[model samples]
Target: MTTATMSKPSVGFEKLSMRGVTRSYAKAAAPALSHLDLELARGEFVALLGPSGCGKSTALACMAGLQPLTSGSIWRDDVRLDTLPPEKRGFGMVFQNYALFPHMSVQKNVEFGLSMRRVPKAQRHERALRALKMVQLEEHAGKLPSQLSGGQQQRVAIARALAIDPEIVLMDEPLSNLDAALRIEMRTEIKRLYQERGLTVLYVTHDQEEALSLATRLVVLRKGVLEQTGTPQEVYTNPASAYVAGFMGYRNLFPAKVENTGPGDDISVVAHGTVLHGTSRAASGTANGAAVSVAIRPEDLVVAGQSTGNSIKAMAEVVEYHGRELSVQARTGPDTVLHLKTNEPVVAGAVLHLGVVPDRVLVYPADDGEETVQPHV
Candidate 1:
């Protein structure tokens, strides 16, 4: 029956789960989370990514046993986590603010967790030194958090988390407080640390690029619902829905109306008061007489002087030159504007030709997230 017991525990015993969990605030219109089902493999990093109010951080709190789940359960490995207290959950957390004690030296901060648990004093000091070395901050062990740069403080926070040798690590937008360059640098640093330790991490962030870069499995959520979950490439290359598609880098979405179905099935869309064709399969079987939206990514757009597969004549409205590439914003006939990222340059207002590969397009039901049409099976 696989009754959630006596199962093998992977490294650090880091399995994580949320089953039918819900959270509601009395004054809010809806639950902060609804029937959420999330799973993280013992050693894999799963990123909880979404916009504000989307239940990502809430889910993390539930798993950490910091906040009570309104319903259902949370678990780590084969044990029910909601049954335990925050400390009993065997979780280590690093917040966005790098919550370290201002008065404590780096070594003391890292040893605090172990000290709380009554670890042998000698062992605690040894583990703390090792944790500081892991983050390359052993030399700063004598300095306080106030004396460190933002990045260094964050690293100390990481060292503190690692000192406990926790069953799992939960990070909530830990790099959000850093500047752009530091953020990029820390992203690589954290990736390396996680890999070296084989740590299971559940990270929460609203940064699409960050999730795309770090997650072994990325979960995209919206308005308290799970939109999609997949490997970064799979989520980006083949989104499960429009909401998820947008998060995966699609920027040029056009409203489409499905008109027919067959080998020569004709879908219809209006641009500049003119009807355009070239849609592949109607997303929904009922799309024949229904409305839908088609998504085309900026990189998938082809710019030139003639029409091609699912091509549209977009008046080059604006152009911005980025170092290695050009950014193009064009009005495709008037109703919609399409954005393209290209290495090539073309004059603005040139009415250049642009085409989207049918296979690369993502179609969504017009009503917006109420329904999803999976690609033909």
Candidate 2:
């Protein structure tokens, strides 16, 4: 978790907004985006997070003018973006595929945007070189796309985006094509680049850890609608709904009945006759005496013989050794699987005791379960 912030770059962060943005293909009866509303500030990195067909990419396209909105408005600062074409938006974009011009050299590809805008040849070359240097790909300037590795091609794509000196950058899972190690490396690098350049980046991805680690803010979408928006910590630690909670790495969540205590009193539930007292991270206060989802983080649960606090006795069902930690899943019931993690080893099918952290539990109304608005992170 140790991270260092990069030096700030001098790019401006123009405001971006979508007021009731809606889009639909003629074949589909309903709009892809059902009156979606979201906004991003300058010098901020925001993630579009959700599952497939959730309109996460579509929302970005509407804002980029790659696709026309059926209704609503896309605005960059005070200017209405709906009337403008893609190029007129003056935005930098890095796609999932690292769309480089194969026939062109690295420097030429980076300079293409400037060239298309009729930027001075000398200035364009200067910008291109500076951008290449930023990515540590100056030597690759003479090379073509086919000559580079996937990571190298990606760096080229980033350089091309920066060459234009655009106020904003939009990316669609740009690092997804790389290996796991490279994805982690580039995620950190991209965050540093955004901070250093003071670039306002609206990135789309389904990686929760990526969004949590890199973004200053986040927008969750489901079926073309905004489920929630907040700081990564806020969204992850305190999701607004069950769908959001489930999307944000909440593995141990199931229906529970609040007993004894009245509405919103220190909530307590029974797991195998153990009175498990815990708090739900739901924004709306939990409704006692009703069936609510009890979600807790796997890390929040500790494994020991018989520990204090709310605890559960269960048979360990599965154990995965993920290098740094042991990922354990315990069978508490026929359908209930409680996850636990430890630095020490634990055998599968061994009867063990688990301690659940009270405050880490998440509660949501059972009815709020169907929406998929975890829109791109």
Candidate 2 runs further than 4 Å off: 1-14, 147-150, 262-265, 271-274, 280-289, 307-309, 367-377
Best model per lDDT: 2
Tens digits of per-residue lDDT for model 2, 53-90: 78888988887788988899988778898999998888
Per-residue alpha-carbon lDDT of model 1 for 1-377, expressed as tens digits? 01111122245554578889888778999998999998887778899987777899988888877788888898776889898988887778987778799988989999999999899999888888887776668899999899999878887887788778665789988887777886776788677666766778899988878987888999988778898899988887877767676666777655666655445434555433344554443344544656777777788888765766467777888999988988988886546788888877776877777776666665566745443322110
Q: How many backbone clashes does candidate 1 have?
A: 0
Candidate 2 similarity to native, TM-score:
0.88
Position 279, candidate 1: lDDT: 42
* Prediction 2 global C-alpha lDDT: 0.79
Give the candidate number with the greatest TM-score. 2
Q: Provide TM-scores for the models.
A: 0.85, 0.88
